[model samples]
Target: MFNQAESFPTLQVLLYQGLKKITVVEMLKTIGQDIGPSTRWTIRQDLARHSVKTLTSANAKEITAEGVIIDREGNEILIRGNTVVIATGTRAVNDLYERLKERVPEIFLIGDAKAPRKALEAVAEGLAVGRTV
Candidate 1:
């Protein structure tokens, strides 16, 4: 969505998040490179460069007839938009392995299949699986 926003000539992109800084889980660094630190700065700079407006410490409380009501620092802020995109994060479901394990001879649980993670970790797992295969 961030990449797509750049193509719009007159579009106003607003990103609202509950957290002040976007960060990756600390445990991710133990397996691979230290990408956690760079993510915050990189995202901040990229968003600014692309003219994307961001509201930190702001969470959507409700959607009324007027606009989206955001709770920011104990204050209510109304955000009006033609379109609303909600990104609530992701959860990993490893149930497939349980059901297929009885039928399948070989099973390789990798990436999100093992647990929820970033693209870098997913790609690393994919590469490792490919090499093993």
Candidate 2:
């Protein structure tokens, strides 16, 4: 996801975040591995730093990539590439087995989410089916 840059050990070049350089480790952690070297580093940095507040306008304008955009009064305009990925996942699809379940008669469900829990279950089910006939 990052563009290439000055690399180090155990890092993947993913995406470019504005002027700020982002690392692979940072990328994964941000997504949600929730664990890495900087995990400790972030904690240490947070402990070392102090918080403060800044004022802003009532309605903040949304920034976009296209068109010439600038900060404040179009002072020193910083051009940064921000990639936005929209993931609208639509996987409400059914499988062949599900279709069969809709048409078939005397459908028996078993273990692991309707799967056999143990080998014995399969054997017992087979035996019961056999006895039924």
Candidate 3:
């Protein structure tokens, strides 16, 4: 009964209609054009196909997202790598990282399990960790 392709647009429209005020804050300076050449093309194409508009370099404060507070500024944005990947799961187990580090010379911990954070932080950490691994 729930088709993602059909439901996503309906959900977006509902959010727009239901919310009296809505602001989009994109931490990334460039949307869909800075990941990499190929990825840039894909993102650009997808955005165009979906008619999604994005605002870049927007600073937000006092934000309650998914029941968590987010504080961000333009200067505080971290862009160490040229790619984006999402890794989602339960909170990171401290013992897992420590135990793995003991058994393996190269071990890196990432995402909310390492510390509860937004998807953006997790993605950033994953990218940083992936480069080392």
| Per-model RMSD to reference | 10.6, 14.3, 12.6
Write the residue-wise lDDT of candidate 3 on 70-130 in tens digits.
2355344332223233222346567877767878767777787688767898899989878
lDDT tens digits, residues 1-114, model 1? Answer: 356545343433423332233222121223223347757677656655555566656667877776678776778888775455665556888998889989988888889878
Which predicted model would earn the best TM-score? 1
- Our model 3 lands, by Cα RMSD against the true structure, at 12.6
TM-score of 3: 0.34
TM-score of 2: 0.23
Model 1 lDDT, full chain set: 0.63
Check candidate 2 and list the clashing pairs.
1-14, 1-15, 2-14, 2-15, 110-114, 110-115, 111-115, 111-116
lDDT of 2 by residue, 1-133 (tens): 7767556532322221223332111112122223357676665444233221111111123346642233333343433336423322233233555768879776554332345245666677777777775
Candidate 2 segments exceeding 4 Å error: 1-96, 111-113
Lowest summed lDDT over 10 consecutive residues: which window, candidate 3? 79-88
Q: Pick the candidate with the highest lDDT.
A: 1
